[model samples]
Target: MTERESSRYIDATAADWIARLDRGPLTNEEAQALEAWLAGDPRRRGAMLRADALSLLSESAGALAPQFEPTPFAPPAAPPPPGVSRRRMLAWTGVGGLAAASLGVLAITTQPAAAITTGLGEVRLVTLDDGSTVMLNTQSGMRVRYGDTVRRVELLYGEAYFTVVPDQRRPFVVDLPGKPLRAARGTFRVRKLEGKPVDILVDQGGVWLGEAGTADAVLLRANTRLVLPDAAGTPLPVPETISTDHVSRALAWREGKIAFEGDRLDQAAAEFARYSRTRIEIRDPALAGEPVTGLFAASDPAGFGRAVASVFDAKVEQRDGAVILTR
Candidate 1:
């Protein structure tokens, strides 16, 4: 086959893959096959990106078609017939004018940004275009913005754990109210709660905390935790090196459980309130300060309250959608 024919074949294959992805996730076998095909030729990745750009453009045009009136001289263009090639579709849609180098830019820019939210007691997992996954915690909201040079997510409220895929060209950055956290390849968790300082934990790889392309950015490595002050110009504390066990306990919310290692009763109750509508009320100051340690279901506030009361030889009362403990 001629070189042109080989290029056309690659583009067609890429178009088919994009279509499959649009329908839904590919099966494991299909995913493996796609990996193998992409590994076979470096140019195939570029072709895939171009095809993806054309597909996004086509979808956007179709969605906006009803809003615009056709030109007086030009009647509405008819849809392409069955078996019409993606190349022909691009030409018909006037996307052929786009330069090849700009395909990646167009693909990222033309797509609309998405805001993902989770309700109280809800945990959601989101998959991005580049295969990175964001696991949103309870009452969390995040906005996704993919640009030509960077993949950015703004954590508007609540907590989320990000498992970012490595892209040296486009660094993955998660923005909080304060400094942005940037990573090339890493798994990290960021929590922003009301009246509390932002908490960041790096699990698998290192993440830079601060503005991008700046020397002042602090790198938080694996098993490191940083508590960022909410007030601007507050002296930043050193990133603390935490044990693996601490990381696991901190992340127990991911598994629908909350782990407490000698946490005060009031602190544990407040943590439970973040996960459940059923409140745990400890009226006595002494009882509230009692130390509690264990793993308990996040959703079962009553069960947790009962266990605490039993251990402390206190009384348990259910009232007005709350679990109360008293001596």
Candidate 2:
């Protein structure tokens, strides 16, 4: 990496570092120094704050795995002018921003807002200024901010697909605090797993993965998977035989239903509880021990109780809106 890129990495790490420090009491001098560092740049403070949140999300997502894609990973919907977007685009160049600026400055305005997000079970489709689209999945949120120098979207929360317009001049960077940002020059899928790891899958072109310190960046080619953490960033090998088939299944929740193939029964109940307003309680601890794996849609607790009952040969009773299950 060049000196400029090195500084950028440091800038990225600053957020996660400050957040780590904030957990402890700092002396007045330490606090003052921090204030100075934050004030040094227009982007410093915001970057640091985002770093903290990114760390937490990465950690949480890592804890859960297998299938892990949410909604559709679409390209930015807004079209970039006659050329490649980021190697060249950002939200500063989009519809909302384009209206205020000349067509000459369109892509500049739309770049940042390219990273979009959605709420629980809520799927969002966003058009980027470069004409690429993003389909955001449920219970997630993120910020897309493009710049003249770089196309950067801070994955504040959740995941999205980025079909870059293909510009070699500027790279598309997906920023997640505590994790090395995924710099894409082409097309790729980056998903955040709560409490576990960040999964980057490249469909076309490739991506460059780098940490916040002195480390060589890893290049992930097409049809590849790379797992990483936010705080302790690392590029892990994705076995060719172990590609993620679960990404599609995990994302099935966008339409409703979680696909589990012989997953533990208790674990299933906990997941069901998140989607169903009426909790699905397992009265027996051993019930959680039983393995359950299959395709089950998320809906009425009463209905799920029936499904669980039939599958497990267990007892299911509905009290109020909650479904109580036992083996």
Cα RMSD, model 2: 17.8
User: lDDT tens digits, residues 109-180, model 2?
Assistant: 133434444544444544454444444544456677766766666666566555554445556677765545
Off by over 4 Å in 1: 1-112
**lDDT to native, each model:** 0.70, 0.51
Candidate that scores best on lDDT: 1
TM-score of each predicted structure versus truth: 0.67, 0.55
lDDT of 1 at 148: 86
User: lDDT score, residue 246, model 1?
Assistant: 81
Best by TM-score: 1
